[model samples]
Target: MIKNIIILFIAFLSVTDLFSQEKPFWNDIQKFKESDRFNPPVQKAIVFIGSSSFAMWHDVQDYFPGYTIINRSFGGSTLPDVTGYLNDIVFPYHPKQVVIYCGDNDLANSDTITANEVLQRFKLLFQKIRKQLPSISIVYVSIKPSPSRKHLMTKAAQANIMIQKYLKTQKNTSFVDVYHKMLNKNGSIRSDIFLQDELHMNAKGYAIWKQAILPYLKK
Candidate 1:
């Protein structure tokens, strides 16, 4: 009986460890908070919140020069990680609009999350933001179709469609479809618009993003 109980306890611990590993973002939040660039003094700012795409885009302020813009991105992060630190990075500033581009990392890292799960997390995040700052507009940038992550395009499209549909029913939420703009005639990512790695955007890519967002910025 003693040996059987010991084996069952070890099995329980193994299951717990597996579950913990599945939530990869849980371990990265502290590092994200420490390295976050958008510190404060961000009253009425247009904050860009997301993973490496936002972090690596070096010309965001120049692209949207009129508004008080803040880039609160950390590379190698996902929506779960952003959700963990939303209050500190997002709500304290009371932003006028939040432009988000997350979930690529979640798709890349996690094996079990379905398109539905990704959409559910987005809905949860929107609710959290609404509760904290009721009047703020939440703008979700559609996950760009990357040549490197082409296999995950179907999942990405499904997630984007769900989010766009949900945003239609909300008061201050909008979906920015950069995915459609980034595609070439063959429905693949435009190689000319991306870096050599085919994962990140080049200067031309940022220009396209800027043009899409120009109309929305307040004078």
Candidate 2:
């Protein structure tokens, strides 16, 4: 009986540990929830949702001073991850507009992941958002040409084009073309805009983004 009790206790411990394990970006989401509880964000603000590009833009609010911006981007997140947490980051805010800057990670995630697959994933998220908030304006920032991900550039461009074409068909949607703006006259990616790691951007890159995205903001 003593041995059986010990085994049962060990099994219980194992299950508890399993349940306690947090997935990627789970902590980030929890932090956002905690912040919201302490000091809630104003509803109907522009909610920027996506991966590290938007995540690293910590001063996004300053870029567009007049606009009420609530950025909920978590580092290294993909379209699927954002879609998964839409309830927590998006709908809860009742955002007047959602500006998405993702899909770069999706292409870089795996060679097997095609441009079409990325488009499909994006479409899934868009559909879910439209179903929930029909009148809300949606904006997609084109995947920028990162010096580190040069190999994936062509694929990323393809994905961006596909997304832009799709967004054109949808009502209240805008596609910001930062990809072309970030390129040089020679068509090579301007390396000066990237940080030391080359994956993320510097202030110069964000400035270019501001110019392209400013026109599309709802107010």
Candidate 3:
């Protein structure tokens, strides 16, 4: 009976693994598709794609009045998540410009993921975007220094540096440094910019981001 039970347990594990492979984190993408069905967004819009930071930006349109904007950010997602849903969230819109705020979640989501690994993921997204869009301008927003995720700041800083340096090498790519601006004079994270969760940014934080990002937008 014990041997039979072990075989059954192994079978259960196999079934679970198969289920996981068949179904990815796709519910959010489905909702976006549904929303688009009823209220289709304009094509060639500026798309802000990333994790919770962009997801929580409720007043993002207010920040930039003259520009056409679309926020396709999904909170609790890493770089792979964004790339995974490229067909649904990214390419469908035919974005004129793509602004990204990821990598922080990549490090915070998994302890084993190295900064260089995060850099590689970003590079993949970069290459894919350039290949697919060709003439589309891209912007990489540096990861913010948050009080809650201070422990992962080292990796975050490294990922930012790597991505920033790489953007310098590519044309029509810009790196907005919200990281340095989010730091206090003593080099600590400025807590006032974040909400009580100490992870997502508040309105004041978005204000600072607006100042940093506006100049880089295509005039």
lDDT to native, each model: 0.81, 0.94, 0.88
lDDT of 2 by residue, 114-172 (tens): 98999999999999999999999999999889999999989999999999999999999
The total number of steric clashes, by the backbone 3 Å criterion, in model 2 comes to: 0
TM-score of 2: 0.91
Tens-place lDDT per residue, model 3, 44-140, is 8899999989988978999999998889988888888888878778898999899998888889878899878998999998888888898989999
Off by over 4 Å in 3: 1-24
**lDDT at residue 42 of model 2 (Cα atoms):** 99
Clashes of each: 0, 0, 0
Candidate 3 TM-score to native: 0.88
Tens digits of per-residue lDDT for model 1, 1-219 = 999999999999898778658865544444445555454354788878889889898678887766778787778887877887787668767888888888887787877788888888888888888888888888888888888888888888998998899999999777888888999888877888889888899999989888887676654
Worst 10 residues of 2 by lDDT: 16-25
Cα deviation of 101 in candidate 1 (Å)? 0.9
